[model samples]
Target: MDVGDLLGGNAWSYVGGTLLVLWALVWLYRDGLQVDAVADKYVLVTGCDSGFGNLLCKNLDVRGFHVLAACLTEKGADDLRMAAGPRLKTVLLDVSSRDSVQKALEWTTKEVGEAGLWGVVNNAGRSLPMGPSEWMKVEDFHSTLDVNMNGVIAVTMSFLPLIKKARGRIVNVASVLGRVAANGGGYCISKFAVEAFSDCLRRDIHYFGINVSIIEPGFFKTAVTSLEPLEKELQRLWEQLSPEVQASYGDKYLDKYIKVQRLIMNAICDTDISKVTGCMEHALTAAHPRARYSPGWDAKLLWIPLSYMPSCVVDMGLKLVLPRPSKSV
Candidate 1:
């Protein structure tokens, strides 16, 4: 080849290599940057019963951070307190109840004192009333929304002063479902709300030297992903439906729905929950925390990608996977 042509090709290759090296170096710098004095920093994580919340409490405790774990049950609190180090404290908190949240706030205020709260992981959430939207009543919807959406709002609003005092991080556990709708219940709706709230909160609180990170995990083997309770809830809703409604869907619909749900859960649910808690830890510890963290492979590979696709394409795919009603034209 002529010298000019060879030089031109090599020049583009050299430029590409330079750009790639710069990007990797920047990523490593951000990844390595962590906050100072982790042992003194106080971080409160909600929903520390038996899932991401529980795992995160232990993970942070091991890293020498002062961890405040909030569980809905006394047993859960006791279990966690037993497992964690002396610096890890547990509180009984039912996020849906105002009184419970208020009590927890007072306790946290006393614990953090002048040092302020470093991080707050709004992780408590429930997934139920999850079948077809028509099968659920207002009360069923309320049950999920009360804990998943309102609970986040209540906890965040109540603790803003402490968070502001420290000018720290607020890590919220949203779901891939938040970005893409694959279900028909308040679970997805609630997460979508969380995503919106976090976006608004980050903008509002950036002046206080605070940052907000959203954790959007795919299906994981947590209490939230258990099929037994979901199956029971589906049966309960089916029984409650009117005769005409039941006839329209036919007897086979419920079974087919359950089967499809089971297949999807089995296929996609990642057993290693550490994938989620790891993201949570980085969000809490990293000096330059990411705006969003999607942990599981399904999150990165499927749900997140689907969220960015065209509505018609997503709708068509959903229609293909989801079971059709007997009454459908």
Candidate 2:
């Protein structure tokens, strides 16, 4: 067949096949380029009190990297210390506070000294009041943004000099919501900001030999995904709403909202959080780390594609799934 004939017949199939092959080759190449001397490296992880941060600290520590695990509570720090090796040190850090971040920076500097920091995992985040945007107050948005967005920027900026000196990695834990905006409230907005910030930081810091990676994970059954706290918060928000707003939404609407939230959480949240921490590991250790990593199957197959679809289509899909308010027009 001539080139024109081939292009006219099964062209899309050929293109798909070619792209798949290229992707496989790139994956193989990436797998082959991992850094050695892991024992000599130092990796600092934030929010190691639980979830991805806690697991990642233990994982990297086992692999021989000196891990500085930062937690918000002394209990959390002690728990991590007991769970991890002696090489794994725990520091109390509240990413939302400048004083806390600065203290942690000084501690890390003292620990690593002239060797510099090899990696910093900005895994501290919170997801709360994730109902319709109209249900949330301004403070609710600020609560999530303070931890997930501003915290990331503060910690990353504080440690950039050390990471640059070591020519190291910065892995920021965002979410599938960041790409797709599937949920409402500040969680998605903060994560979206994280993606933007990470992209800009990557480009700006590449000259310093610093690699920046953003981890976009799908629904994971971490504390952040717990339905109980969300349900409680929803109840609180409902109670706090003005009489007019409450009358419009009605108790039935609130009940349906909570039910749907619980259903979605149970159905989609992956219990095996290792899928996420594993990506963080690769971002820290790989010689040619990718700019973005989507760990969960749902993230790669579902939400990422949804994120790229037309806005109207996404809106319609969401509308179909969301519970209609009593006075919805």
Would you list the clashing residue pairs of candidate 2?
none
After superposing candidate 2 on the true structure, give the runs of residues whose Cα lies further than 4 Å from its correct spot.
Answer: 1-23
- Tell me each candidate's TM-score: 0.96, 0.93
Q: lDDT by residue for model 1 over 111-185, one digit each (tens)?
A: 999989999999999999898999989999899999999999999999999999998999998999999988887
Candidate 1: where is the Cα deviation over 4 Å? 1-10
Residue 145: error of model 1 in Å? 0.9
At residue 183, give the lDDT of candidate 2: 74
- The lDDT per prediction is 0.94, 0.92
Worst 10 residues of 2 by lDDT: 128-137
lDDT score for residue 62 of model 2: 94
Candidate with top TM-score is 1
* Highest lDDT against the true fold, candidate: 1
